[model samples]
Structures are given as structure tokens and as C-alpha cells.
Target: MVYQTDLDAVLDFPILIGDIGGTNARFAIVVDSYAEPREFPVLFTADFPTIDDAIQSVLDQTSLLPRSTVLAVAGPVDGDEIDLTNSDWVVRPKQMMKTFGFGDVIVLNDFEAQALAVVALGEAHLEKIGGGSAETVGSRVVLGPGTGLGVAGLVHAQHTWIPLPGEGGHIDLGPRTERDYEIFPHLERIEGRISAEQVLCGRGLVNLYRAIAAADGKEAPFSDPAEITSAGLERSNPLATETLDLFVTYLGRVAGDLGLIFMSQGGVFLTGGIVQKIVPALRNGVFRAAFEDKAPHRTLMAEIPVYVITHPMAAVCGLGAYARTPGRFGVETAGRRWRAR
Candidate 1:
């Protein structure tokens, strides 16, 4: 059952919306334009050999047969095969269409779906940190620190929102303080240099903890990020506590830089499991102070609102929105969209 349509055509319902990350794959089905997205239980990538197997498991449990799908992946969406950055599974949209008997498939970067969620989400779904009210009109940015760092920008134009996704997490990070200079040399480098992702992600938290321990000439014990986070938040270990402080500080600096670059007056959103877990630390003056530390544009930075996305299915909701009303968003589908011809 092949469906033919132009580049700007609205996707036919029912639609499968997915947010595929390194650790988990979340799926939802929207039966129609007016119907809410019915979410399925989260699936671990390791539990399934391929994405097809995961989807098949979900299909076995439900009666819904979606005609189209929009998948937000953790890696770059280019060519026919899309590989997840931190996972072993590879997504092939063309192959999916044949296997699932779908008409269309749209691929998006994970952060791009996050950017779309920023526009679709309401106040109830956001937790404010510090800063003035968001501007009624302007660009917005969303950053997530999870298995890896993800970044995207959203801009309103021609009465529609356009999401811009890029590899902003790989940007270089340099030390600015005496404390930073002491610990940075001990940080693990990707290719001889430490990027923002080196100290901002899940493994990055462990890296920060080890670096702090190494700088103090102590043996690091914890290997898991959760252990470090628990010790830091509880103040059970001095090294873990200091590591969390530096982690938030560096996150603030990076967020401030992105805020200035995009002039995100709409707001700057912080997503992923890591941000939500450290909300208490994020509001404890250190994060906000570092965000406002931009000398030349301190005033401008202060006016930009920052929020943490509280909704668990934000990316799936974003894809559902696009599936329901494709004309409302200016998503470029030239190469990313595949059809069963």
C-alpha cells in the first residue's frame, strides 16, 4: 500500500511517533488529528536486536496499525541508514516502510524533536529556574545532557516554527577559573581535547568525579553516574559534592553561550534525565549566577528565561504535533522523509 504525496503534504493517520535514545525507545500512536497519542511502555535498546523487533513487540500488544511514522533519533539523520550515537541499533526508514507496510517515515535528530517540544509544551510542563519572562516572539533553544549532549534551536518565521539541529555538544570547553585549571588536565579527552559533552553527560558526571578525585590526589571509588549523583546531592562525599558544583557551573556557561548565540528570547529549555534529577542544584544560585556571568551581555542574558521540561514524553508529543499538523511546522523533509514507491 504505497501512498504518494508532495514534500509539504500532511501525513496520513494513524501515525507512529517515536523518540529513540541511547538507553530507551519510546513510542506512541496517534489515531487521528483529534485523538491523543497513546503511549507504549518504554523499551530498552539492549532488549531488542533491532528497532523492527521493538516495534513488532509493541504491535503484538496493540491493535493500532499506523500508516506513517516520525522518528527522532539520537544521531544525525543523513542518507538511508541512521545510526544511533550511543547505541548498537541502526534505523533504516526505507526498510521500515517495507517491513511495517507504512506509507511514509520522517527522521529527525533527537534534539530537533526537543526543540519542537519547546513550542508545543505549556507552562505546566516547564519548571522555571531564573530570569525574566520569555519574549512573545523570538528564537528558542533546548539542551539535554543524558547519554550524550544534544542541542537544537527553534525559530518562528512565516507564521511557523522551524527547528534547527546540530552537533553543538562537541564544542570546545576551556577553563576560566583557578579551580577549573586544576581539574581540567585530569578530565578524559575524546581526541586530546575536552568538549562540553566530556563533563556534561551521564558518563561525563563520572568523568568529572574522577577528575576531581585525581586533582586532589585521591583514589576514585564510584564508577556509575547515579552513585556520584547520590553522594553529591546527599553531601556524603566531598569530592562528589564539588564535582556536581563544577558540573552545574560548566553547564551554566555553555547554556549562556548558546543563549547569546541564538538570542533565545522565547526561552532556553533544559531537558534529559540529568537536568530533571539535579533541579535542586540547578536552582541553588550557582547555575543562575554562572548563566548571568556574561560580562558584555549580562543584562540581556538575565532577561532570557530558562526552564526544565518536566514532561516525560516531550519528544513523542512533539512528533505527534507534526504528524497531526505538518503545515504548522517548517520541518525540512527533502532528504529525511522516505516513502514506499
Candidate 2:
């Protein structure tokens, strides 16, 4: 499938860049091509009845008018109306252009923004995991486990970066080890099938804990992922500890799979709140061991680098990069871009 599109579009100066997710919406204003984005405080989606209200709040606070906007939303960017995968807020680029009097409005998937950040972010913003040096010219993968699991690929062709976003998180995942077999049967299923998100997201941690507990015939006392993580990190609960180990192992496996699929010699980056929190767990040998267990391709996988994105505003930074120089990235804006009449 053709994943890249060539469209002649330029966002005017004083652009508004937003990274809208299920729980939080972050906004920033770029005064000019050379100016850095001035970010506003994050807003909870629950507090705002609609996306319009949220944008208005940011405008009121900033008191800076923007002629164009670039939004990174949590769901697919298809057609005029876009609905968030995990929230009630619906984003309509055409409506936004009309409401805000914008000359241009460009929308992209949240993970696509993450993939762009992989290119825009410097080494200081990334914490290295187990792997060799990243090749200068190869595809890259960025996946995050947060409110949900997001996956995207970044490719370099024609001297421009291309971000490929898809529902890779929903891909089927199965057990490969004896321990996995024992826990797989107990985990909850979506439509009677297990996907990567089933055990890789925030709620996925809780699911893993519960499944592990069920396998051991023990009562699970924790329902919140944070609680389980805290207990696991502190070594206060065995079940939580086991859950965390398995979670990291599975994450490594999935990252390795994507790395092989894209030949991501540039790197495989891990993003989101969960990854940042579990840096200690990821550094343990189990994660890397699982990642390199692909048998025949173990040597090749070992040579690819892995990193955790440490930037607090990765998506915002990505949008800022695109707004500053749209030609630097090959973004498909056929149905995702709106213009003033």
C-alpha cells in the first residue's frame, strides 16, 4: 500500500500545535518559523465538554492568535470528522478551521506524531536500552504503552522522513513459552481474542496482574496499574513482580518483531508514561533476552538499538517540527488537511 503522499501545503506563521489524547490535551503556539513553541498547561478531556471548548481555553490563556493549526489526535485521521479512540471528544478539521479562522488545519494520528518525534528528538531526549549503535540510514519504530498501545514506523526516502501509523497494537499476540501458556488462558480477551494492547497498556498491567493471580489461584487485591507497578517495583508483592517481568518481556518481544519487520536499524523507540516509569524493569536482562530470542535473526536483532523517549512533550515537539518545515516530512494529507474557503 502507498503510505506516503505528496501535497503542496504550508502552515502559515503563528501556528497552533496540539497533541490530543484520551486523558489529556496539550497545546502550544509557534509564533514564527524560527521561534520555539510556547506550550500551555495540559487540560483534562473530562473537564472540557467538547474539543472546541478546550481550544478556546488555550486561546484565552495564551491570548495569541494562530493562522494555522496541526493536531495529533489519538485515533485515525480519516474523513472530515475524527473521533478519539478512547474519549468522547470528536475532532473535525474543517469545523476547527471555521471556528478558529484558520488558513490551514492538518491532522495526523497520535503515534504518527510520535514517529515524527523520533526524527526531531535529539540524543539527549532518549534513554538507551540494550542494543548496538543505530544505523544512520534505516527505518525506525516508535511504540508506546499508555492509556492504549500505539505503534508507528518512520522511514527515510527521497531525503524526507515518512511516518507510517497503523493499528499495530491490535495485532494478534500468542503465547510462546510454557509460562505464557499458563497465563494466556486466564487473561481477558477482546472479542474472544488477545491483542498486543491486551497486555501492553496501562490497564494491560492490571490485566496481567489479575491473570497471573488467577493462574496461581490467588486473590488479586490491586485494581489500579500504578498500584501494581509500585508494589512490583518495591518488591512488596510477588504477583505484581511477576506481572511486571512478563509485561516487560512481552514488550521486548513485540518491539523486536517490529524491528525485524521494518529492519529498523535506525532504532526502536519506547514512549509513553508506562515506559518512563518502568525504566528499571526494562534495563533488566529479561527484556533484552526475550527481544533477542528470535532464533535465526538473533544476531541481527542484537545490532539494532532501543531507546525510551524522555521528552515530556514529544508529540508537541513533533508537530512543531512539521509546522516549522513541512517539506522535511512526507505526511499524507489527502483527506486529513483542511483549508479556508
Candidate 3:
């Protein structure tokens, strides 16, 4: 529902916020407008029957009535139901409001919340991947490969920052090398197509390993992605190492393409579980080299900054920020050009 006044202004303090993903659901209570929030233990989505069940467990901790709640879900937020991309829980804002007796509830795409969090992150929360200093007056893009790939953009508009969210992971993944072309056909295609998500997510890690092994006519060990990553990181398997290398390289290429598409001179932020686990591989120059390999605009690519978000609760931080000041986020209005004040 649209609020008459800004929702941020009217919402009560100690707001409940969440970043719900395929594997885990993270929740926090913002007690003060500017203070660090009280967080709950990470809840696995598979353990809960519905989103309501998960929230109920959190409420059981304090037994207090919250003024409002904002949930950052790992999928598109549309119409009445917010269907999770990788989870079974279907979150309905209006239904949730009625069930919980909440004054308001806001649902956002997980990456949309991450895009908001970009403004809240400090130097300590960011690990630089490559590029020069971020542009102070340009767009910023944030994408993450976890259970799924998420893409979003943040831009200043009308004295506020607005989030641009889309399903960019579903786009066809283009190959840039002979090796990539050789392995493309082996990927477990989605809907008879090879989308970026099929090669950039947790399952995608396994897909890469299998395809690489098949191309070389060798048998792949470690049936799952975790085992493959373990073998790759432990330096026990050459095939696994090569698989991860290709994965990171392709990720860099996709990230660079996104940088160009959004003109994200401000920066490109990478988040989510998979990138966090494979950070060492990402910093070894392969990823950066591929990122800046763009023809003609390679110079521009080098100038655009890149970062990996180390903060785990970044989405929660952004949701809290929006909860405190709705009008400041520029999400309520549209088409207004922003100025740096």
C-alpha cells in the first residue's frame, strides 16, 4: 500500500528487517535510527514451512510488537505474492500484514536491498578487486553469484539514491574464448537455454567442473559444488582448479559487461556466498584481466572501480537505512534527475 506520508517517517523504531535467500534467512531488529541492529541467528529456509514460520521464531525471541518489517527476498517482488527464486516460501505482503498485525510491510528484491546497502558500506566493508578510485558522480552496479545470480543498479536522483533492479542473470551467457565455447554445450541448460545463472551460481560451479572434465575426457570427482570448491581450494584436483578459474574469469567478463551496460563508474560491488568463499581466486589477476579485456573500451573498464562486499549484513543495513528515511532513498518517485549535494 502507498503511504500518505513517507513510510519511513511513520514506521516505529525497533523495526524488523530481513534478507531472505535460498539457503538462509537473516533477520535483525533496528532499535535506533543510527545504531547497529540486534540480529538473530541465521535461519535455514529449508527448515521452515513458510516465511511466517520463520518470522514467528524471530518474534518469539523478544515477544514485542514491532511497528513494521521489511524483507529482502531472493527473487522478483511483484503484485500480491513475492515468489522466491530459489526457495519454496511465497511471501505475500498484505497477507503478512493482516496475519502479524503490522502497520506496514515492505518487500524488496534481495539485490535491490543490496544496491541500497552499497550507499551504507564504508571502506572497512569493501575489499577492492581492481580499477582506480570510484567515480563520485556516476552510477554504481551490484551483482552477486550465490544460490542464484542477482543484478541491480544504484543511481543518484532527486537528491536521493534510487535502486534499479532487474533479472539480468537470465540473459544468455556469451563465451569469449575457445575453451568457453568448447565447454558451453555441456552446461545443464535451463529451459533449453544456457543463461548466466546456469554458470554463475552454486550449482553452476558443479556445472563448470563437469563440463571441463567432459571436454578433457576425464571423469569428474566430487559430486557437489562444495566438494569441488574444497578440492579446488585445497589444491588437490587440477580439474577443479581449472573449473574455478574459468568460473571466476567468466564472472569477471559478465561483471565488465554489466559495468558498461550501466556505465557504473561509481563502482561494481560483488556480494553473496559463492564470491565470498572464492575471494582469493578472484584477486589473482585473472578476474581483473578478463574484466578489463573489453576491446576499444578496455581503457574505460580499467578506470571503473570494482569491490567485493565483505559485510554479511549489508542488505539488512540498507533496509534499516530505508526504514529510517524513505524519502532520502528516492524509491517513491521516478524519472527525476539527481544532483550531488
Candidate 4:
């Protein structure tokens, strides 16, 4: 959808947009509203051992100095208590402002940035996975599974875009078939009360592997989700392939269900570390079928376009998108504690 933001105002020097994830913090240098953002530099949080150190490393790489910055983080963003969902680098926003000497340092949920990006991204930016011809305006759901399942919705409110944050990834998850019931029991040890996140996200790959293994009357054997995916790509491990396929199928099912719930006529965009790793696997075949396999109401859901966000730096674009939206985020970095609506 077209976002006619007078973003022409975000001058190059003061604006900085960063997407902070569990593993690496992606940073981009912005010159102005219309000028293209520079190549993203990924800084491993582990390399610096602290977010501030990582921030400094990025600044050291870039020549332009930014006065205002928006940090998109992968965790629940509440006031100044921004604890990263997967990592230990907790950001104290007020402290950050004092330390960085920024006039405005706005932090928001990472998925929220992904949602806001929908307004700025066009057809060339998106990779179609399922659904039909898209329109310029409509309600959309932008979510994905990675270190953890993240959810966000883009509601086109008249002339502006309203990015809605949701704890949807934590919503109760249930079994659709008898096989699933058996699978849930095996996961009981780790996930007493299963949420969609349990079978999605990075750790989710392991859950899927275990569930499938348990269903096969065997123990799921993988140290981590990454291992399982690597085995699946190698095609030498039968169990890994089956596990990954089931993960994709279930991912489609859950995303499809979300589309129906939100009536996300605008589109259902799947973006995250999981999809990026399995892009080739998802591009053709069963994944799209499962995404479009909604029963009874299939016709209505089928038309909802689904895209796999190919751009790794789309989140940064999302930050740019949000900055363009007026009254979207109010900033007050008076002190390590931040207060916002």
C-alpha cells in the first residue's frame, strides 16, 4: 500500500533506524527521506558483549552522525523495561539517550516495525507465497517465527497506518487432529501449556522435530533448530526433512488462521529468520498448498495474498515507515526509564 507520508522531512543527519534482534543488531545509515538507505551492517551482539558496544561499533563504521534513533526490538516493549526476548542485552532507553547523546531515541516492538513496513514496501519488495492479486489498501497481518514467534497487524485507518502490537504468538495452541493430540503429550515436559510459539519460532523447529519423532515412536534427536534445518537441507536425514515439512505446514495453518481472524484482506506477510533460512523450501510445493488449505471458508481466505519478506533489512525500512507516520511514537528520554503510550 502507498504511504503518502511527508517523510521528505526526516533529514539525513539526525535520523538513525536500527533493528535489534536476538543474534545481530542490523543498522543502516539514512541520508534523507527520499535518499536510499545505505547497505545494512550486521553487528553480532556477542562480539560486542553489550548493546551499547554494538551501537558504538555500528557508529564507528558509519561516517554520518545521527541525533535521533528508533530502535526496533524483538520483545515486549513497555516503558523503559525493554528486555530482549531471546538475548540478555536489555536496553534501558533513558540511559541510552544519556549515553548516546540523542535528542530522541524511540524503541518499539520489532514486529511493529515489520507491520509498519507494509505501508512502505511495494510489490517488488515482497515475494508471493500464496493468495491472489493484491490491492493498495486493506487490513494486513505481518508476522513470522524466528527466535520467537512475533505478531503485528497493519490497520489502514483512513489516511494513516496504525501498527497494532499483539501477544498473538503466545496465544493458546491446540491440536487439529488426533495425531496432534499424541504430539502434544510428548511436548508436555518442555511446554506444559503450549502456545503457537511452542511449535513455531527457532526453538519450534526442534519441537516439530520431536513431535514428529514421537509420533513415529522415536525420540526427536536434535541439539537445536538450526541443526534440524541443516539436516533437512542436506536431504540425508529423513527425520529432519519430515520435521521441517511439518513445521512449514503448521506454520501455514497458523498464519492462515490469523488471516481469517484479522480478515487481513490487505495481505498476510510471513517474515523472520525461519523463512529466510527455508526460502527455497517454501518457494514451491506443499507450503503454499498448506497456506491455502483453509476449509469451508477457503474461498474467502484464498484471496488474501501471502508473501515471504525476502529483504533482510525490511525491518529497517519499517522503522523508516513508522518515522514517516505522524504522531506514531512520542519520545521523552528524560532519564534509563522511558514512558510512552
CA lDDT of every candidate:
0.90, 0.90, 0.83, 0.74
Single out the weakest 10-residue window by summed lDDT for candidate 3.
Answer: 332-341
Model 3, position 76: C-alpha lDDT score: 75
Q: Which parts of model 1 have CA positions greater than 4 angstroms off?
A: 1-7
How do the residues 1-341 of candidate 2 rate in per-residue lDDT, one tens digit apiece? 34333347567889999999888899999998788789999999999999999999999987689999999999888788899998999998778877989998888999999999998889999999989999886899999998889999999998889899898999888999999999999999999999999999998899989999999899999999999888888888899999999999999999999999999999999998889998999998888898888889999989989999999899899989988888888888878878885
**Residue 115 shift from truth in candidate 2, angstroms:** 0.5
lDDT of 1 by residue, 79-100 (tens): 9998999999999988999999
Provide the clash count, candidate 4. Answer: 3
Cα RMSD of all models vs. native, in order, equals: 2.7, 1.5, 4.4, 4.2
User: Better model by TM-score, 2 or 3?
Assistant: 2
Poorly placed runs, candidate 2 (over 4 Å): 1-7
Question: What TM-score, computed on C-alpha atoms, does each candidate reach?
Answer: 0.97, 0.97, 0.93, 0.87
Clashing pairs in 3: 157-338, 158-338
Q: If candidate 3 were superposed on the true structure by all CA atoms, what would the RMSD be?
A: 4.4
Compared with the true structure, model 4 gives a TM-score of 0.87
Model 1, residue pairs in steric clash? none
